[model samples]
Target chain A: MNRTFRNMLLTLCTISLMAGLSWADTLKVGVQAPITGSYANEGQGIENGVRLLASQINAAGGVLGKQIEVIPCDDQGTAMAAAICAKDLVNKGVSMVIGSYTSTCAQAAQKTYFNAGVIQTSDGTADSLTENGYWTFLRNSFPNSAEGEFAANYMVNVKKYKRIVVLSDFSTYADGLGNATEAAIKKLGGNVVSRDKIKADSQNFTPVLTNVKSKNPDVIFFAGYYSDGGQLRAQQMALGIKADFIGGDANDNPDFIKLAGSAAEGAFIINVPSPDVLPYPIAKSFIADYQKTYGEMPPSIWGLMNIDGMRAIIHAMEQNKSFDTKKAVDYLHNLQTPIDGITGPIAFAKDGNRKGGAYVVKKIQADGTYFNEYVQ
Target chain B: MDIFLQQLANGLTIGSMFALVALGYTMVYGVMKLINFAHGDMVAASAFVGLTIYTQIMGQAASLAAVIVIFLLTAAVMACIGIILERVAYRPLREAPRLSAVVSALGASLVIQNGIMLIWGPRMKIFPELVPQVYWDFGGVVISLIQVIILALSLFLMVSLYLFVEKTRMGAAIRASSIDQDAARLMGINVNSIIMIIFIIGSSLGAVGGLFIGLYYRGITFNMGWQYGLYAFIAAIIGGIGNIPGAMLGGMLLGLFNAFIAGYISSTWADAFTFILLILILIVRPTGLLGERVAEKV
Candidate 1:
């Protein structure tokens, strides 16, 4: 054959192979959460956020000119169910996943995503989850790293707390908050006069209150969910122990106000910076669109992550010009866009966490509503 | 020393709450030879009732009459639930294999919690604190007022129950029924009524436990009953399966064991310690603190 013909044939062969290997034809992402179990109500909000974002992206000519398909996987809010969902999503060739809202579920699926070489971002903040890797997982921008300094900084520096009593459920998730806040308290030259660990599901914290009372701490720092935090506050006030009950992101739930009733007033939390509370211009439009479609405000914790994740994925696909895993990931690492992302035009850190991150302070209002008080 | 005593005093109050709930398990199992696995949900149900009443009675100051009325209402309403559950669930399967009844009880429990969720909603509602957490200290041992009352109330119930069982005619009938249902039936005692009564009493006790649980803990939920219920059931079994006094002893032992273990060792091992203690007791005593020696028949 002539040299020119030989080179042309070789070029044609390479181009054909490249065309065949391009994964743009099937742009696939998986969104996972519990459609059942304890967190189902909250999970619905998360699913809605991501789904709506994906829909918006698809409406905008789809990712890389191919239709973006988001596969919904049910974690059932349990570890085992989440692992099963992870395995299925991996098998379906999903290059990216947003999933498994609770820490326990996230833990179960982390290994699966890690092994499958799929990137995942979860709404859960258990201390151990994203500690190991940058490739395998990302949290909703906020990691447990914030809870330590955030809680203490708010109470000690912002709220000017001095004598504090720390209450913890000692759960896999809240333990981080507890350890963090306690250390922060000590670091600020303030002391933890009392510390008590309760069963995670404990309804009564009165006995602990007595121990707390002896310490006479001005603030009662509780690291757990709304149910326990609010209940502890209500019970303490009913007894008139009068310590300002403080907590982490768990307190940023309306359920705390409902549970604490009149006692919920002035209770403080270090929390996720809300889509509603963000000073960024995108929050207003996002909230309006969310309320218009879903008939409610965006959910407190898990919702924004999924929305931001979908935006990230779609943006990555657009930048890569293909939906192939390697290209999409590389795009994710490099692509930057001013998306009106729910958690404030989120930028990822080198470790793929949200840049300019996490809420430092929130307050529970009189009517059982939570509002962000400070964001940096 | 002060902190140590104070924590013990604090834990004792929690132990008292455990005892109050454990009584229902012990009493129900003592006569019926059934686990009454639903006893925990029964606690949830009664708490719901109190919570509903608390909502109604909000903005009002605490009164002795109001307290008595609420307690009586809780007992009566829960007694009815207990009786109905027993009639529909237990009596039909009295002659059948025991496992079926236990399974049915579990179903009933699941149904009850779900029913509450349906009737109410999935969101956990906080019941108003029934006990005012007034603190009273003796030297260094600080006792919350709720703890004092739970200790007093549980003791009052226990002493009265012991006296009634040991000294009253109906109590004799109950004891007779517990010992031998067939014998009690042959002696013209309505064994069915006795069983119904047992259910009512056990559930009423659970109802009070539930009410006190609200005042003591201040948070009530659809599933709050299970944690305490599991511990109560374990206490019942470890204290010789169906012995009343044994259940009480077992609860105290378990509580003390947990507190000491958490204090002495890693707090994480407290659960393991309690379970290990149960297994050890099961091996050594088989029956427990007040449990009767049952001769294994060859």
Candidate 2:
């Protein structure tokens, strides 16, 4: 009776092991984002978008004849937390990572993903993110330099602002954009009256605004996140500074309107075409499905851009019929035809930066809706 | 000259809030020789509680009467929390080593900060406009109505606290306990009750600071306590850790330093310059500007 029981247990164990092996055949995609922190709205949007796209792909047919498994890690919008998330995700055996709303978090986790041979696609726009020449790193969004050039041309040529004051928080992305814009303005012979830095989330920009007002600036360009951007606009108005307020790409968030309140009106935000404004059918359908699923629009263009990055990576994998990182990177770098992305045609430069820049300057109307003023 | 005046006005507005928060640190340290690291988080939590009361209970009412009512209710709730925190986190460890209590305080700080983050969902909440946007421009120096009210309210609270601590019988008990807990206890004073009272006053004052910040800045986050708390802590130390009036002076001085430094020098160097000045002050006056030098008891 004992021998018979042992044989029966062995047989059951073997069958369960086989079932586990079949279940484990699925591909793992990691999402590293600030799912909970000051930038929680943006992080949550990215997570939601990635999940929505993954589900749609799975519904049609699993990737490579296997289901796509999503493993999400919340970086808390901090560099330290992002480093830990990167390690955690890599240890989970993910082949690719779609993540990190902020440039600081993305840059923090960049090396870890590279060392582990995992492909990482981020919406972080810092120019330095691609400067390291990390093959594993791909930027879904255009670099700060691209936006800077566009902003400089518009401010100098189109608007013809005489005294422009540049403001930024002490974050990697904001500082980079601020410097880039400042340099671009100087290059175009535009007078940058003052360059100032504000402590992010300090909740008070009056001191800085007052100082800027003293300079008699014609326009004030703030290169910072929406959290600070919105407050800056509100305080700028409170201080009765009549200068035109322009916000960088990071200011393209719904909360900017809510936080700035009525001050959001007449403020201008420069960013890549917002998700809702994308003319691509793929973008529209994806947005509709996302809205149907999440019951709200994606927080900003960053979420959709991240989704497009994921789509492009998966498409490259499908083209090559391989899950290898090296093969996918090569395919993405030298595409015969650019994959149709929600934001635009998805292509990458040699240094992993996104090819082409299509930024739009949108004016915040009185009703808290964006009016596309100019597209470049 | 206009910029200087405007910067000064801005300095005073921020300094008042810092002074209010510094009072909490000073009071708690005065009575119990322990630095309540969690005091800042308490302020943040109170602001959130105030937000809830304003939105849910008050139905987003913007009347001055409703604002005052909300402030009182929020203070009361924070006082209760303060009492509970003292009992659970500090009371048992009171007999332990000083470092142990400090560690416990740090732990409490983390617990409260994370607890708030978990509860509030870690997003920056926009504080609705409690006061109408009205600016008073004095020859290029703009001062808003809310700024005036904040200055008035902060000054009123600080003066009231000063009077209470100086004149009231319970205030006498608190001062006595701070001077010598054992002696005060022997003198028929309930030291435990005195400590509880100190927590109540400190927490309530910090709560008001939180509300003031929320109303003024219009942005409240879960971890904002760390930054604001650090500034207030520095203020308390600069004024002399256990000195109430010193905290006030320190806060105002710090605020002025920040504004002037940012206006005249560089905004990025304001914090760095402040720290250097703090070091200079400590080297010159070990007990702070107003801190009385008391010989250590053997």
Candidate 3:
């Protein structure tokens, strides 16, 4: 009786092993990020999100009833490395690509993906990306230009600042953000005392900070990634400069708190609305299901968008009921299905932009990051 | 005026970092006939070791004493690594062709840097700010307490180093090795040990550089050493390769040059100016300010 039971267990194990091997040949989604360099913290979320989403999709009977495989590439968070990932992905035969943690990197990869006729979804929303118009290229993340306008409006209209200062990294994204924000501030009857671009890796902005302090600007809008943002925040507060730090999405990370410590307590930053998953049952269910399967809520906005990007592609494939690239693009262009996504009310506009219902204001709080409901 | 003073202070603070890192480069080149390309990354590795102690085993409340203990432990470990690199990777090729030795050092550098990334991770973490930044003014110039301390410490270290090399027997033997390796070896000196000693001392200097970088920047990415390392190398070259005082001059000059460019020249041209200065200097003085053309013996 014991020998017979052991033989039966061995037979069951072989069958499961066979199933695992076949799982290797499932649908592949290539994910890219700056996993090898200075921007790795930011990149970590973007890469992990692709896998998190892929697992979710695969669990739902897979895409086209086939399991999903997430293939990730490291771009080291640099532009040049991102381009290489694009080329490498195309050769690897991934149908669509999700990538690029920074605008600089997205800019480089967009060209490569477009030329290769491969599809791409990016989190970095540099304005120059709009000109490409690759039907295959789509950015779910709002551009920094929009962020700039929103930040400026909030400072002048809500805070009622008389004079504002602008400090931007010389990145294409930050510069566009700074320029648009500067215009917004002036339109609101606010004067710009100082506008300067600091080096991306600059350790100190005391020169710029001091000048602004001397001018006594009511508020300062800093446009840069979290690395520089945190340092500037710490130094500004440490030196007794009282200007409020207003920045865009790059400041949306826990690392900012780690760098600035107590100095970051009252700092303000602008970001698109993450669906208030707590209050809304639909969004809460999505988060619950995600955590049950993957063990954590999507850490950053990129996780939800990446999952949404995969769903968009999979939804398109189901509509056409095939793996054709053009068919997928057509489905994305005319996405009409009221898919209940984790981010709420998923639908695309004519120009491939997420509908206005999306973009919400989030505030960093002591307990957890909070988002204000959009009152449109 | 407040902004100008602040920027000036910022420049000096960063200059202090360059000075510390520059010492490692200057000293190694001064004592050995080779540049330890791995010095900067060794600093990075030590910081990671320090960080591992803080966030992992020790927990958040790791005391000031614990932090210092970890730092010294890391420094000692890094010293051993530096000595080993000199012994195994470098000493074998010391008598070989110059190009081969330089290439070997470069290869060692790449290995050490990438090895750290593989072992730890590539993600940037917020390093604990070990010291607080406060301010004082001298002659109407704003200076942060941290910056003043950094400057003062660097000056003290450099002076002590100068005195040791001028007065001590080991320092004299190290100097003699650089001047004439064969002569020192024949003079009943352990030439290899002196070279190892130079590396250990230089690596400790790099550890100091790394600690300062962690505190001042308050964030450390895996690749933090590359750009800073390159800049220090440029400072070393500009000061006159293998010259101690020259490295100091180069670091100060580079810092002042960058601050002036950002302040006076268009801020957009700040990055372009550094390269332009390097190119112009290269054209004018290929061997740098105080470098001498040494004849080779076949």
Question: Which candidate achieves the best DockQ against the true structure?
Answer: 2
Q: Work out the TM-score per prediction.
A: 0.81, 0.95, 0.89
Score chain B of each candidate by TM-score.
0.93, 0.98, 0.88
Off-target runs (Cα >4 Å) in candidate 2 are A1-23
Where model 3 places Cα greater than 4 Å from the true spot, the runs are A1-25, A274-282, A285-297, A357-376, B1-4, B56-59, B62-67, B133-142, B282-286, B290-298
User: If both were scored by DockQ, which would come out higher, candidate 1 or candidate 3?
Assistant: 3
Encode model 1's per-residue lDDT on B1-298: one tens digit a residue: 7656755755566566676678788877778888888889988889888777756764444666677778888899999999999988888989989999899989988988888877766545656545554666576455666677777887788778778777999988988988898888899998888888888878888888888877765666677678889887777777776777777777766666656666555455767888898888879988876789989789
Best by lDDT: 2
DockQ per model, Cα: 0.16, 0.60, 0.41
Is model 3 an incorrect, acceptable, medium or high docking prediction? acceptable
**Candidates ranked by DockQ:** 2, 3, 1
CAPRI-style grade of the A/B interface in model 1: incorrect
Residue A207 in candidate 1, Cα distance off native in Å: 6.1
- Cα displacement (angstroms), candidate 3, residue B235, comes to 1.3
Model 2 chain B: lowest-lDDT 10 consecutive positions: B261-270
The sequence of per-residue lDDT tens digits that candidate 1 reaches over residues A1-376 is 6999999999999987765654446567787787654455566777787777777767877766666677888786667788899999887778888876677777888888888878888867775776676565766656665777777777788778678877777656677767777887788877778667876554545445655666777888888766567777765775456667777775666667766766678877777665666776666777788899999886575677766776776666666666555565556556466446767665665565655665656677776566666775
Which residue pairs come into collision in candidate 3?
Answer: A34-A77, A211-B3, A273-A360
Say what the RMSD of model 2 is.
3.4
lDDT value for model 3: 0.73
